[model samples]
Target: MRPNIVVIQADQMAAQALGAYGDPAARTPHIDALAADAAVYDRAYCNTPLCAPSRASMMTGRMPSDIGCYDNGDDFAASTPTFAHHLRAAGYHTALVGRMHFIGPDQHHGFEQRLTTDVYPADMDMVPDWRRELDDRLQWYHDADAVYTAGASQATVQQDFDDEVSFRTLRHLNDRVRANQAAGERIPFLMVTSFIHPHDPYEPPQEHWDRFEDVHIPDPAHPEVPDPAQDPHSHRLRAMSGFDQRETTDEEVRRARRSYYAAVSYIDDQIGRIRERLETLGLAEDTVIIVTSDHGDMLGEKGLWFKMSPYEESSRVPMIIRGPEHLVPQGRYENPVSLLDLMPTLLELAGTDPEVASTGSPEEEIAPARRGLSLLESARRERSGRSGPEDRDVTIEYLAEGTLRPQLTLVRGQYKLVVCPGDPDQLFDLVADPSELRSVADAPEHAEVTASMRAQLEAQYDLRGLEAEILTSQARRRLVAEALQRGTVRHWDHEPDPEQRYVRGDFWGALQHGQIRIPQGGAEGAA
Candidate 1:
């Protein structure tokens, strides 16, 4: 039987913020435990740092620009064939729960069902306008308020939405198990439970907040860089988010970090609950659980508090895949991987004969230039004491808010090249200088490596041409967004089917079969 797949994602969670990824400040026991027996990717990154584009890349295994997902407000066209569609085609039931933040119509995007609505808007309201002046702040841009007002909260919109996500996720898991049991057979499932916690507002519940009350929360390694000394992209993000105009004290930074850590812990607890449910339902041995995030939150690194930057704190994400030992290897991989890889990884995991993988022309679905290798194969090679592929190059893009031109990153071997159109190219040897405090782009000794990587990056993308395309997309979306606001709105948010959820009259029989905590304890009508 094929293994059941569950991908639990946390929004804007940095690899540096998790204990599994070597963050001592993180209180994520469940995630760490999962990492202990899973394939932990030490160098996993999102193809894009922003939320919508990053997820779009993950779903389609294509670069954000390739699919026209330029920013938060861009629509993920229903025409796109996602991992869900591929898996479903391979005889798996797929569902989405919680925040996907899919903009525009067609919220499903090949998902057979959605148990909860998205936390953010599903319209083009949050689109970024590249036509505007670089310094002019948009209505939906990030600000320093999330940092200055960070703390524990009794109740918040994020908390409420995440709570609903957890509830519906558990219910869906149970429903699947019960349905399979009733049919006297197994059906593979691909469910994505995405949470919006730890993203912003920097407010976690008091219970999780108190866990770090006495613990030491360190400050940013690199303090605020003067405007003249900051990198072009970082400087753009700072000015775009009002980071230059604001004054966040040390205490505020600590509170924000503490709250962010608390939110991570909260997400960790949710993971624990999902695992426990799987075990109780006798699905643990046949289920593959993937823990990761769309992108990383900078927190207070270099005085940047959010994503939309190419720094490690904002781009690197934790990716852990846990399943039976026979199916998954137990080891950490230093090879760089990105969200774009998940599509092929998931398709390979769906079964021995997934339609997309067996087609012999996967490029028909996933373009060759944007295609990613299967990490599962890489793990198998690692377990056999064989060297994995040598020519591994992971690319990341930041084409969303907080920039004048596109920021493209090329991670080849140990060196990373950050290139913008006019700004000087910035390069860092990740192995030697993990903190990326300095640049080796102009160093004569490493000139060969920098030049080669820069050539490869430039070859892969036409930055100026891409920028013009992005500008055109932004203008078109802004016009649509404005026109929609003036008329009677037809919201595209997903509304859970009442007939398919809970103990509704139409769903009573199915709900009862799944609701029975004790097997054959009593009849359905018996109190």
Candidate 2:
């Protein structure tokens, strides 16, 4: 039988910060130990860097464009079939215990249970307006003050929420274990224990903050950000994020860096507790554990603060999979895989195929997931002491708050391409310049490679049509958001169904078996 699945997902954590990833500043002993026993993917990235789109992609096993999730406000259509639905169809109980950053009202998204509501507002309030200029910034944009104001916090809003997430997850596990024991059954579970720590506001708990007190935190490789006028995309992000308004001293950067590292360690501590609880219940041996982040923090790298840009710091995420010793392979894989692949990957682990599941959906809407290969199969091949088939092409999309238009990234092996409106194409050779300080698009030595990648990107995406679709989406969402935010706001926030009963019938199988037709503008679909 397939083991239970536990997803410990983090927010805004960069791959560079983990000791497992060779960061000297991180105090993540727990994560390092987990990596030692798990299979690590060195080049895994989120298809879209922003919170909602990337997370939506991971959940549904589809690209953001496939699901029409361009920004945080883009509602993840309930019509989509998620891995939870697949697992649930296979008799696994699914639950989410923390922040999923789901914007719409239908927050359960196939999870049989959700322990808490999300931290961010669950509406179109955060919708980005391309028509709005820099001075007319969105209300949700970052303040440079967050960097300057960084320090140890006795208590913070994020810490409190994550603490509750951890508690609820542990309590849920204990409940399940005892309930299963009393019932004399080892019921399967797919639990997502997510956390919002190690995200920005860069203020960690005082104790975890003190743990890194003596650690030397380095400033961003290029602390001097580019001029906004010259690099419109970078400048737009910098200005909208409010980084353009402030001049900070070295002290501010150091304080922010230290706090971020401490924040990572704080979450690492929580991971230890959750893992210990799983072991205590004798579930570790039969559970498949996954640790990853939605996206990465810039941490002042290249003068960027948060995700949204196509830079490596913002695009890449950390991923580790620790499954049953006989199943999961150890050691690192240096090929490019994406969070977009998670849906198919998890589905395969649960003993179903994405190809079959794609055909199972009522409308056959699960196409993008079929595009990604499962890492479970790949890991098994690697365990036999042979290399697995390599997929070099990774497609990344950006249509969030930062840009007036859309952006795309096509990464093939060492050369990565980034193309957006108003900025010249950027191509970086990661093997040659890992920091991505320079774009060799203009170099004659790499003309053929750049041209080839550009052709691939253009062939893959229709820029004019894609931009039109995005604009239409933005306009529609903004119009709806405007009329809805009158004297009273109808919240789309998901409240956990207090009656946590598990229905035995397959959720997806009902669709596959054609027993139920998914309703149009389903009860939960309307704003």
Using lDDT, give the best candidate's number. Answer: 1
Cα error, candidate 2, residue 498 (Å): 4.7
Q: Which stretches of candidate 2 lie over 4 Å from their true place?
A: 227-230, 357-370, 380-390, 497-527
- Per-model C-alpha lDDT, please? 0.84, 0.81
List runs of model 1 lying over 4 Å from the truth: 226-230, 352-369, 382-390, 500-512, 515-527
TM-score for each prediction?
0.94, 0.90
Rate residue 18 of model 1 by lDDT. 90
TM-score of 1: 0.94
Taking the tens digit of each residue's C-alpha lDDT, what string does model 2 give over 172-246?
A: 886676556555677888999889988889989999989987788777988667544445788888888787777
Clashing pairs in 1: none
RMSD of each: 3.3, 8.8
